[model samples]
Target: MIDTAIPHKPNPTFEGLKRNKVWLASITILILLAILSPAQARFSLAFTLDALLHTAPFLILSIAIAAWAGATGADSLIARVFTGSPLLMIGLAALAGGLSPFCSCGVIPLIAALLSMGVPLSAVMAFWLASPIMDPSMFVLTTGVLGTEFAIAKTLAAIGLGVMGGLVIYLLARGGALADPLRAGIGNGGCGASNLRTPQPVVWKFWTAPERRAKFGREAVKTTLFLAKWLVLAFLLESLMLTFVPAEVIANTLGGTGIGPIALATVVGVPAYLNGYAALPLIGGMLEQGMAPGAGLAFLVAGGVTSLPAAIAVWALVRPKVFTLYIALSLSGAFLCGLLFQTWMGS
Candidate 1:
């Protein structure tokens, strides 16, 4: 109030930023030096293989499903309906989540891209809440790694949590707290053709018409290409994590201590961002080595919800407050799900 006309001077030098860069570079150099030893590299490679094995099945399935959703307009239909009704959206999201391989990190980029292109918040949230636990990759890997009992328990737990999470979000933002950020950005510019209002095409009546069939086929091709463009990078990044990270380290860090595993999994995953496909084999190995099923679930849920890229993409549309709330909501749901698994299914 006293100095309204005075200009504030910002420091011109990026010294703080420079220091951070130097520190990060030093750490990377040290890690590389350690890996230079053949023995250590071999050990690292073994863990990498386990991670890759865990990730493979889920990635393949999720990509396939995403392609299907994109081509058939299922994603757009689901988004439109779910955005209007959070409860139904959540249930659908939870159910779909159970069968996908995107994990938290992998899901984030793809989901964020979908949201950017007009997917509903509820469906996106559902994917966040459920995908890690529900995938075939996780089911198969955990069954082999931790036993059939654990696998069955995990699948049930994921569905339960996915439904509950979606419900909670719906209740919290019932009157539109969860507006579509991408749609908001569109204003009147017609950003997302997918999100635009168009005359309903006559479906059954047009089924036999060659012109309609051709149009539908063209739309399918376009949608598939759009989704694949966003997903390819996620797949490649997941592969890199699988190739380099140590499964033993993850297992040990996330293994036990009751809820500590859940909390640590949520926190640790903020950066590591494991793909469900890549995460499965590694988690299986960990369970084989005595890691708790609850911990594995936490890793899966938290890792999917806290992806860095997803956060960045979402921030573009929603305010920081909404994005932070989204993260908190997603993580809390994941944590609760992990605990639920422990409470009901633990050995």
Candidate 2:
């Protein structure tokens, strides 16, 4: 049985959010100003609202999943899944990450929990780096938009890159090259419930408890606000690019194949790729405009790894060194995947 007699602790994440509310509010106000700007008057309020509404379900699902995972005996289950072998754990964790329904952001709570429970950071890195690249729904959407080959390649890349990341971290940990893989300070951040003082005694039957619901509600509010703040900024930037940037220019810049375009695709993909779901049609449009299939793959993989919201959630969870290593491995794997897929497409 889990302990119910727990004391209140300062939720660093929530407190940090509260402190940063001013910045968030400032960004919101700026977005409104941009919308109301006479030069930008034609900018659609509907577009901004649609983006927000579109992401609502994902955000909600992230929070609920976090809450449920927190309340369950998932820690033991997660640990049990990995035997003593580091390689096996890395392979399985990466595979689990790709197969799991959770997104990069939604799994934050669970990752935090796992790390807190002494789960190998290397194993978690494998899962973390891979989980966002593709999921079942994302897979179906990619196949429909990009074709079966691309989708399958992406799924494979997610797993492969995850393993690579896990192994790199594993070696790093073994050599004592890095310290504190799980960055200290941020507690229970992301879609996961904050201030999880205890695992709530009921474990599996969590829905029956008032405390669980309350915890869920608290996390929901914070996650929504945190995501919304970054999203508004991202959307506003996207809108400006759509309005002012020319498709022809983009096509010319990223439309080619080979190493140059592939490298650009990987680098630009970090900012270019929006949330995974919305990126499909946008990518399809780019492909129609002569964007190389390999470049597109690079963009998708890199973007998923480096997207603002997901990246922020990760930065909050881990130290700067680990985060930097993650970005390097992700982009490296993304480029390699793009190279392989590019050759396949040309063939």
**Best-performing candidate as measured by lDDT:** 2
Query: Superposing all C-alpha atoms, what RMSD in Å does each candidate have to the true structure?
Result: 11.4, 9.7
lDDT (tens digit, per residue) of candidate 2 on 207-319? 67787666656655765565565555555555555666788887788876678888999998898776776566566657766788888888898898788988887788788
| TM-score per candidate, chains pooled | 0.56, 0.64
For model 1, the superposed segments whose C-alpha errors exceed 4 Å read 1-35, 39-86, 97-124, 131-162, 174-253
Worst 10 residues of 1 by lDDT: 187-196
CA lDDT of every candidate: 0.56, 0.72
Top-TM-score candidate index: 2
* Model 2 segments more than 4 A misplaced: 1-80, 186-248
User: Candidate 2, after superposition: displacement of residue 247 in Å?
Assistant: 5.9
- Candidate 1: tens digits of C-alpha lDDT, residues 239-344: 3334465657656767764898887766766676644434555455555555667777776667655566556655654656567766787677677777878776
Q: What clash pairs does model 2 have?
A: none
